[model samples]
Target: MSTDKGQYFNDLRTIQANLPTEYSRTFGQMIVHYYLHLIKSSHTQKANAKGLKQQAAGILQEFKRKQSLRKDYPATDLLVWVAESNHLPQALPVTSLLKEKKYRVTYISNKQQLLANPALEGYNKIQVVLPKRGIIAEKQVKEFEAVVSSIIANTNLAIITAEDIDTISKAFREYVTYTRQLQADYEKVITNVNPKAALIGYDIPTEGRTLTDVLNAKSIPTFMIQHGAMAKVDGIFGTHISKTIFVYGEVSKQVLKDSGTKADIKITGAPYLDELMKKLHTAGSKAQGKLKVLVAFSGPGHLTTENHHKKSIEAVMEVAKNHSGSVEFYFKLHPKDNRSYYTAEMEGKNLTNVHFKLPHSQSNDIFDWALFADIMLTGASTVAIEAMLCRKPVISLDLTGDYKELSFVKEGAVKLISDKAELNTVIEQAVLQNFDAFDASSRKAELYAKQFYGPTDGQAAQRCAQLIEPSLN
Candidate 1:
């Protein structure tokens, strides 16, 4: 990478390091949802309460729509809140994927606008606004606290640690900013616990704070999740969470020991990834047509701290030109990002071999495309991990920033790069390589699942449900 590019990547990492804990990512989402609701309700380009009320109304409609599903299954009163991803396959597909495995699922989050429209009425789902039995408010700290406190009065909390605080802080604003307040509240909850443990999804939310202080405050067992596959540079991976941290792989466990987290950790794999692994096993259905590779365009506000997304896209375009005839390359720009962002670089050039996917294309369709593709390409993403599990070869180019330092991509598991030249070569290799050649990597993906999670039998939701079944009953 050139000096300028190197500096850019360095700056990106610095911003990532400063990101609020992952818990904060949800808060950012809420703010986005709040504003978006405001925008759509007014039907005007202006921002005001009218628009916000419209957004809230839309969410309420979606909640009622989802709630309608339970009308027939009265015995199933417990609300299952699956996180809604506006990016990859919305919450419906997630719940559908879970249902396929015989687990009943529901929608519970702020992004309920997607489900409110008449177009989604074909699907039977119930959404609860308030005064409902369950709330899937992942980052809605105030509401989440109230609900958890009511149900799990004996609930314990934990915080997973990494170098990124800004990202987490932005997502879980109320929880992190009001740490002392939350800590005091949690103390009251931990007073009643004996055998039950509440696993807080602390995916890299603890950074600047001392792990020991947080862990000690909650005498209740506080558990954490290993963010990704481990490698050298994951400073003190297992040492930060309570004595019982949940890791994805043995490498992560070893890295934790190397970092000095002496907590007795368990390998719960990744609860977040359980849905993806299920897709991999059932993808034997041969998919026809072009082997597609999707490049998700994320802006500086989300995913990247630096404005290198266009540069990365240009590099992929350069490589796509090489095999455009046989292999297909698609770009899914972030909802917030637009084509104008790349006006200078892609203005005159029209690469017939490449295509740009608008936000209308659901993330689930992309995942389905990933299933049929000969290989998948990305800059730096957890999506690469999912691609690997789907048995597709992955080529992760380090277009900019501290991508080389990420624990998951650092391993040879993902192909990293700095510019168009390197990405071109990686893409060429990925497209031509035989699928069978990746059996070992796929198995490693499975092992990554088992070591961290305990099973890959497509029953992760069922397994998770098993843990919470008695509570619901």
Candidate 2:
């Protein structure tokens, strides 16, 4: 098991060196990271001991051998994703592979069709209908409860929560209700499924929350998969307490030291970015003409506190109005945001130069657009990391206060734009800047990402799979 664990991580070293530079540590957070990493490592040690005793090494090796030989063997179950539309695209490759590996696939949408879309053949989907009259919170919990009951009975639970803690953008207090409901619903689902092994995509940003309360309370062996640059969010301390944490590069392993998170942190490069890189390369040569810029706004979170969606839309609209034909702006809305927000700002205006993109578009489709864009704009979306992976320039706009905590912004991979006027000037300069030779700072940042993310070779998922299979009993 130890040898398997070591081998799993060794594959990730190359990936770490390839991480983007924009994912650097900010001041004051290093100490906390180190301490947290230490704690997490200790927890992993304990979990490993249990696995070692429960399943012997000989059987584990045999399982691997069987996995190799039985490529055509059908998986016993399927993973059903009933998530929002934006998040759905990210899971596509995973779902696709699961099917190829012989596992059935199912995807659920929050709205629209009830009988599941035909395009998702062999994949099952259920529409989430809410009670029309009740409070939104009550409706969500009740609806989730029904789904949880059905899923737990039919399939092995494949839990995927980007982060355990949900934030409220309005008043800090408003977060309490959503947070509580999420916790309650998640707990109910996990309890019913009684998952044998679970995967955590990233470290949980836990400050006051307890891992045992959110997870582990039921003793589920969670396998953590590092989703992006090794940036820490709140409740990360709790992540240190997870049974095991998987990472992609050495830089991320080092980041745990700074964030004070200690898990048995293993390098498993992110599959999402890996696939993106592959698609970019296969698309043929890089851009030849005017740099296309895609501007994305991640809404209603720590950065856009107090429903600044209007302000954000106004800011983008102002840019569209000003730049119209000079610079083509592709606006990608956050999955969580309502389309009404975009319609409210863009409806009657009839702006042809600007395209406002919604969720559900293939991630690759969007990436295809982003690849040609000379520059990119965003308000704290991890898409910045994607931009770096694509070798495109990016700017992050922070309307609210939490920009400092963002790793890429701190590393200067992204420029901070606080207001509409400042954003306008920065966008103009970035788009017009000649790329005859990539900027030195930009090159340096890319080198930094190599360390932060691992390899740019585009096999993050394969690397992650090797890292995980060994550890699972």
Q: Assess each prediction's global lDDT (C-alpha) against the native.
A: 0.45, 0.49
Q: In every candidate, how many clashes are there?
A: 39, 55
CA error at residue 278 for candidate 2, angstroms: 3.2
Span of ten consecutive residues with least summed lDDT in model 2: 163-172
Residue 433 accuracy (lDDT) in model 1: 51
Error of 1 at 55 (Å): 19
Off by over 4 Å in 2: 1-195, 200-215, 227-242, 250-257, 260-262, 282-291, 307-309, 347-350, 358-364, 399-401, 430-441, 470-473
Task: List TM-scores for all candidates, in order.
Answer: 0.51, 0.58
Q: What digit string (tens of lDDT, one per residue) describes model 1 on residues 182-288? A: 23322332331221333333323321122223335444344434443354433334224444565555666666776556677555445555556656677643345
lDDT of 2 by residue, 1-473 (tens): 01111111222222222323321111011222222232233221212223654557546644553343333322223323233343333345445555566544434233455234454666644332221111236554444334333433443322311121111111112232333443454454444433344444233332112222355556655455554345534333333445666665776676666655656776656656655675665542345444356877666532444355577777878877777767667777665556677778887777776766523465435576666566767776767766776677666666655565666666666656778898777666655664422354366557656666776666655654454443333
Scored by lDDT, model 2 comes in at 0.49
Residue 71 shift from truth in candidate 1, angstroms = 26
Of the candidates shown, which would achieve the greatest lDDT relative to the real structure?
A: 2
TM-score of 2: 0.58
Candidate 1, TM-score vs. the true structure?
A: 0.51
